[model samples]
Target: MNCLLTGSSGIVGSHIMFEWIYKALVEKTVNHLFVVIRNNKKPAKDRLLAILNDSSRPHFLNDFSMADCLSKITVIPSDLSNIKKQTLEKYNFSTVIHCAGSTSLQHTTDSKEKVQHQNFNVTKQLLTELPHNVKRFLYISTAYSFGIQKDKVTDTIANFKVQEFRNPYEKSKYESEKYVSETCAKKNIISQILRPSIICGRLIDAPFFETPKFDVFYAWAIFLNKYARKASSDFRIWIDQKSGLNIVPVDFVAKAVLHAFLQPNIKELNIVNPTQILHKNYVGDVLRYFKINAFNYVSERPENLNNFEQLYYKTIGVVFEKYISVPDLQFQSETILKFINQLNLSTNLGVHENFMKLIDFSVKKEFKSSYA
Candidate 1:
């Protein structure tokens, strides 16, 4: 089998590439892996070769088999937004995985126009230009595209009219997803979409450990800890103690996406927050696990009556005060759970220890470097 993967250098895309390589080695299903990357300044061929040949970086997440198997991969240069049908036809790909997108949540309305245009244009081009020999098209989308719907969240894609988005990233994703779904349906292309919620590092092993630290919430929490200690404040933030904070690990998301690819009659999958719990309670659990004391000041009215609060809220692209009060901010992941069970897979992908280790590792590194 042959496959083409975009966004091969990104956090999620890199992990997906490793996971697929691992699976290919184990199942002996794929022989050639074609990776398409954007060539802005550096040529795609040289950049990909450098990454594949690098021995210093931990590209396989402690799995040597994946790195070894990566030798069978081929790097291709193509602009996703304007990829030609002839270029894709040369690969004769049996499957195409689309994972490229601007994940910058802080992008303002004005800043997001270019990104949204690229995303939509690229997807449309891919759908129309894909070789007929390709068997499936898989899209990786964000669970946040569901917006702030607090009711029983279903697997169905969110209707833009129902929920209001705060940032361009979310708006663009929601729009792109709709376009992809419609185009796929019209063309009768076998397709699957995976929506993952806030993916954090492995949970609760240590503060300074060997793992990727990519969770914004965890990063913010660590930053808050430093600022709180330095300022001699109680580190209290007002929040609705009853709201739910949905989070999943990156490994789980990758595994779920791969499993969906192998399954039959699986059109759409959500890999995040299958089960929702109270946000304050969830955060409290994480904090308690780390032996951190956090004071929660529950208030009916919004707090932070200063310009700093306004600026901070705008910077994060989230109204922390309003987020705490969202009654139904949970992702439904029943499809992901069923798919995992069907595969008979049991691994430490979603364990809390991994996340904790990453957090500690980042914090200690910051402290030692005097960059905290």
Candidate 2:
């Protein structure tokens, strides 16, 4: 059977592509691979080559050549929602891995519309346009799609209202999940929605690339690092210290995705780190890493701050404060844990040494400069 994988250029998708390629190289379960990438200045094949050559993916390049891998894969350049029926017929895919989606946190009209279109519309179109041979559909969604709910988020479709979303991205993904659930049931498709929490950089350093990094918290931290001169040590950002952040390294997430994909019976999975870090501690670690001043956790925003302090708060707080202010969420991971145990995968939660390695990886890659 062949596989159709989308978002081959993204962090999670690229890692997934690498894992699948490695699996294909060894097991040969997948006969052909169709990678769907967005139209850009660079060709899809060129982009895939860059990913294969990316320093973070050295494991994939250990024993293979670009020519050898490309022989088994077809890079399709087009909007995912616009994939033609003829192309689907030609590929006759059995496994469809839908990892492409808009991930903007901005709430502007255009941004919201784009998020909805890319996340929701693309899923609808793919479900409708895919051929009958397609058996498995794996969707990459965020655990934050649980929204501002109180209960623990389990391996089930969250029943969240539109207003509960922190931003358009979450709302769009929630809507897309609902649509995928309904469509899969109606069309008798075996679907798996994988909700990963706060995917960050790997624990290994890599070469610098001009591409944008997908980690939002790290991006904000890097921004602060670049503009460290703009604000003084007195500047403080308030947050709830008790709230927990369920974060996972990108490499771990990739392994979880593949393992969950091979599981016997699964409808939904929460690919999250078992040991969650406190939001306040996470922020403190970042600030200390950047040599910034200390910050105290408060229930509400503090008053009487300097102009630069206010600007700093507004700049980073607007997009990320919701995470720090919300109540802690419990992301159930029984299914993924089972798979990890069965596969004997590394369940290394990013803490202490791993955390430092992750941040250092970003530093080596100069994420601060590019993001700032």
Candidate 3:
């Protein structure tokens, strides 16, 4: 049976296109593949073909040829909301992986009410209008869907006790995931919910140490890169000494997505790093890359600040500070380790090992974009 994939243009989705879909084609597990990429300046096939045809992408994750994989795939150029029923009937899809959604973390009313909530709306719309032949459904939800978990986060959903979310994106995913799980149970569809925590660059899998977007942690890296001047000198940046952020590589995420499909019995999987780079060590490489020596992680908030610190906190820090100052939540991933183990893929380390590589790549890319 064939599979229909959404969000083929995103970083995680594109990685799956390069790695999992290619591997699946070689293994003959999937007879064919269908991709739903929204129309942009170019047709969906042309846009997605450009990404798949990148010869410079790293290997060792999969050894399939691009041309062979291309022949087995069909492009459906439609938005998630716009996919017609006739298209599903014609394709006769057995599995649908819904990975397309807004990742915006904005807390503005318009963003929360419309943009971020669009994830939930689109997901609901798709599930409500699914074809009877679609027996399996996979929803790519964020690990942070735990919202503001009071303590540890298990693979189980009922364990989440968060009343309020840090941002609308987190809240939106939580709502969407809840809807997917509950709806799938009623419809008798095999549902696999994969929650990925802060997807970044690769550590082991193909395109080793590569990332499409330098976002999340890399945004902070870019900030430090910008702060390379004398202006940030002696200006303290506060961090949580005990808590850590769960940032996993894109390849690791792609691996988890593949395994989630393999082990459907193991429904919910947190495709998160086995370990987190505690807030204290999260910025170590970026700080070193920029030769930054002014920041320190403190359990308690600092009352005193220099002029720069004052200005920084009042401005961009208002948003960034929200990320660090939150309750500690340990994401459980041992259940999925059974599947990850089969592939002999390593996800033991978090973002620390290749942090500098990400910093270098992002900084250079940012520089190029800024100048270009």
TM-score of each: 0.79, 0.90, 0.90
lDDT of 3 by residue, 1-372 (tens): 578888877778777666656566566555667888777788887887676765324474235565666777788888887666776777757898888887776667877877454689888878887888889999999888887766667888776676677788888998898899899989999888889888777776555656665656566666556655644556566676677777777877776787677666868888877777777665555666687666665554567876666666765566567677654567767875665677675655436766667668777667322100
lDDT for predicted candidate 3 compared with the true structure: 0.72
lDDT of each: 0.61, 0.72, 0.72
Q: Candidate 1, 281: how far from true, in Å? A: 3.7
Flag the better candidate by lDDT, 1 or 3. 3
lDDT of 1 by residue, 148-186 (tens): 564656677743244576456667777778888777777
Question: Stretches of candidate 3 above 4 Å error?
Answer: 60-65, 228-233, 303-307, 345-347, 367-372
How much RMSD separates candidate 3 from the native structure?
2.9
Error in Å for residue 243 of model 2: 1.7
Count the clashes in each prediction: 19, 0, 1
